[model samples]
Target: MKRYARILAFGAALAATVISSSAAQAETILKASHQFPGGKGDIRDEMVQLIAREVAAAKVGLTIQVFPGSSLFKPNDQWNAVTRGLLDITSFPLDYASGRHPEFSATLMPGLVGNFDRAMRLNDSPFMKNIKSIIEKQGAIVIADAWLSGAFASKKGCITAPDTMKGQVIRAAGPAFEEMLAAAGASIGSMPSSEIYSGMQTGVLDAANTSSASFVSYRLFEQVKCLTAPGENALWFMYEPVLMSKRIFEGLNADQQKAILAAGEKAEAYFNEEVRKGDQLMIDTFKKAGVEVVEMSKADYDAWLAIAKQSAYKNFAAKVPGGEKLIEEALAVK
Candidate 1:
């Protein structure tokens, strides 16, 4: 009996040691990258960081390291990197990859999403479903669905009317917005949001269109004299979501995958709660700096939408397959 007891104890200790070794071997570290500034209240960065924290707390043998402010990948290159498995994850603006996937241009189309509520509603719409389908096909998957509303800031004048953009050198975020601004007679200069400050400071850009959070985060009030903030007739809404490489995601064990997904949900919920405050912060910060802030009137919005239909909308429908259907699906939400 004594001999049998000793043998059983040895077997139990060996099994415990093997399980401990396996658990240690299972820990994984993923790199998460984004273009926004970290540790400075950029909502996009906060989203990524929240994911990191949540996953760490889950104790699921998974850890994420965040690289913000274009530290790891340039803004436009993140989509390509993540989809190719060179990057583990990213907080990315989907339209930035539209050069390779023309259908993604619809995500940033003018007048497609005009307000926070509509932006939220569109997440479940066929338009986004199609967008996500494309993402999956490209070897990445959306972790969080984030829609940011933006506005125009001009050193020349308030950009409330189509004519106001005339002759001004402008930096618009994506191809669709650039097309619309070009049709309005503005000279278009393309650059990432991080460059907007320097572009305006050096006279390379007389105006820019970007998210409200960027205005405050980049201190654009120091560069531009007037801001066209989003109000009742918001015009610019862009989908910027946290994404993971499908290939990398598939490599994770089931527990690690569950932890990552849960972290994403928590991060998304945090964004929805903070985004409105971010917009307000932009408005207040600009006002305190004595920059003129204006909202687009209903009439102004209608005029811009009409121009968009003629230029951006018309071009997209004619160029991209199934583009018209995507627009119809987005509009049908309301």
Candidate 2:
């Protein structure tokens, strides 16, 4: 009987040691990358930091390492990298992945989303659900939902009127907007926003379209002489969501998934609030920089919309499968 009791005690000790070893080795690590600068000031950076804070506070045996300003991957490469598991997550603009899914180009369709409230409703909207469905199949999921409104800038003059862009070189953020700019008779320049600075300086770009926040963040105001800001409502609205690879997310335990998702949702709310304020803040930044700033007027906006209908809208419906249904769903959002 004494010998039997000793064996039982030894078995209990071994079980406890095994459990402790499992606990020590169970940490889940996520590598997050983005094109925006991290640390502070910038909204994306701040939100990502907030997410990290919340994760740490939860103590879910999970940790995420952040790489900002394309340190880990280029802006265009981040999406595919996340899907390939070379990256775990990214703060990505969907339009950049339009090549992977042409339907994604609709996210940047002119006048589709002009303000925060309408833009915020997109994730649940049927139109966006369809888009998300396609993205989910490609091995990624949106952990955060945020939209950014954009504006146009020119080197010598404002691109307020469609006719004004005649014969000028321009960068129109994405293909949809690019089609509109091309219809306006502007020669389209293909490059990322980071390249826009040097492009403008070297006479490669006469006018460029980008997010309101980027206008100030990239300091293009210092490089360009004229800035067109989103005033009240603008045609350029891009859906920039932080996406996580489905394989990595599904690999987490329920507790870890819950904690990370909750953090991501909170970060998205913070991002939306920052983006709303950023529109006006960028305009102010440009004005103070001694740059001539112009807001798109209603008449010019209407004219641009007319051009877009013939260019971007028509092309999307003809080219992308189910594009017509998506457009109808988006237009019926109101």
Best by TM-score: 1
- Cα-lDDT of candidate 2: 0.86
Ten residues in sequence with the least summed lDDT for candidate 2: 37-46
Clashing pairs in 1: none
lDDT of 1 by residue, 1-334 (tens): 9999999999999999999999888878899999998888899999999999999999988889999999999998999899999999999988899999999999999988988888899999989999999999999999999999898999988999899999999999889999999999999999999999999999999999999888888889999889998888888988999999999999998888998999999999899889978778999999999999999899999999999999999999999999999999999999
Candidate 1: C-alpha RMSD to true structure equals 3.2
Any runs in candidate 1 off by more than 4 Å, and if so which? 1-24
Assess each prediction's global lDDT (C-alpha) against the native: 0.92, 0.86
- Of the candidates shown, which would achieve the greatest lDDT relative to the real structure? 1
Off by over 4 Å in 2: 1-24
RMSD (CA, Å), candidate 2 to true, equals 4.0
- What C-alpha lDDT, on a 0 to 100 scale, does residue 1 get in candidate 2? 97
List the candidates' TM-scores in order. 0.93, 0.92
Q: Residue-wise lDDT of candidate 2 within 199-231, one digit each (tens)? A: 988988898998887777778988888888888
